[model samples]
Target: MDSLRTCVACRRRAARDELLRVVLSGHRLIPDDRAALPGRGAWVHPTPKCLKQAVSRGVFARALRASGRLDAGPLENRLETLMDN
Candidate 1:
């Protein structure tokens, strides 16, 4: 059976194939589109605006249960690159 995951920002539950997965590597947030990362993941709508909204509203931090501040630059950059491709 396929796994299902929910987007923290959009509050939408979707099949594993439908959402974008992101992970926090130390102080950086990186995209794990293949869903193979072994850590807490934050999901967004695979859109740049949604990514921005999640970061600005602190949803990503809350979802990951991260105590320290998060660096959104890497996340935003990865999202932008994905959007471009």
Candidate 2:
């Protein structure tokens, strides 16, 4: 059986490996590459456009279930780095 997870941005179920896992660490968004981050996790496609949509449209916050500030800088950099790999 394949592991399944929901993409917070798209609100659709996808294979675990098919989506990127994002976590909320207090005031920041962290990419849980190993999916081992403890806490609530959000997910989005491994695309820059999706990242932009999730951040600009407040999808991440909604998925994370918290209302606070968010910083996209490091997350964006991390996504770019992952895309390169």
Candidate 3:
């Protein structure tokens, strides 16, 4: 069976494969497309709406157990590019 995870932005539980995994690298957020990144990771729906809510509401830091704010620009750009393709 597939594992399940909760989306930090929408607060909905979904299958692991249905969501995108995000990890922290220094002070920036990185998208773990393969979910192979080291360190604490947070899951979120791979949607623009979820991404916006996660960033605006500062959910990634909380979910990842990261202190203070984290740079989400890289994640945002990644999502944008995915949407474009």
Candidate 4:
């Protein structure tokens, strides 16, 4: 069976690889561009709108099972870079 995960921002279930992966690392939220990082993870559509929604809704923490605020700046930048490639 195909693996599935839900987008924390859009809250839609899709193929695991179809969504971008984010992982918690040292109290910071890092985007797993290659989805290879370990630890708790969160999923979201690779779009600013979804990222914004996820941030504004404060869902990353819960999804990643993290406490306090998370830094998604790097993730956003990485997304932009990936999109540009």
Give Cα distance to truth, residue 26, candidate 2, Å.
2.1
**What overall lDDT goes with each candidate model?**
0.80, 0.83, 0.94, 0.85
Model 2 Cα lDDT, one tens digit per residue, 1-83 = 77888776667788988888888877688888888989988878878877888998988888889787787677888988988
TM-score per candidate, in order?
0.85, 0.88, 0.95, 0.88
Per-residue lDDT of candidate 1, residues 1-85 (tens digit): 7777888777888787777888888877788878899999887778866787787788887888886778888778877787788
Top candidate by lDDT: 3
RMSD for all candidates, in order, please: 1.5, 1.3, 0.8, 1.4
**Per-residue CA lDDT of candidate 4, range 16-66, in tens?**
878988888776678887788878789998888998899889899888777
lDDT for 24 (candidate 4): 80
Output the TM-score of candidate 4.
Answer: 0.88
Across residues 23-69, which tens digit of lDDT does each residue of candidate 3 receive? 99988999999999888899999999999999999999888889987
Query: What overall lDDT, based on C-alpha atoms, would model 4 receive against the true structure?
Result: 0.85
- Minimum summed lDDT over a 10-residue window in model 2 is located at 2-11
Where's the lowest-lDDT run of ten residues in candidate 4? 25-34
Report lDDT (Cα) of residue 78, candidate 1.
76
- Candidates in descending TM-score order: 3, 4, 2, 1
**Cα RMSD for predicted model 1:** 1.5
Model 4 residue 31 lDDT?
A: 84
What lDDT is obtained when candidate 3 is compared to the true structure? Answer: 0.94
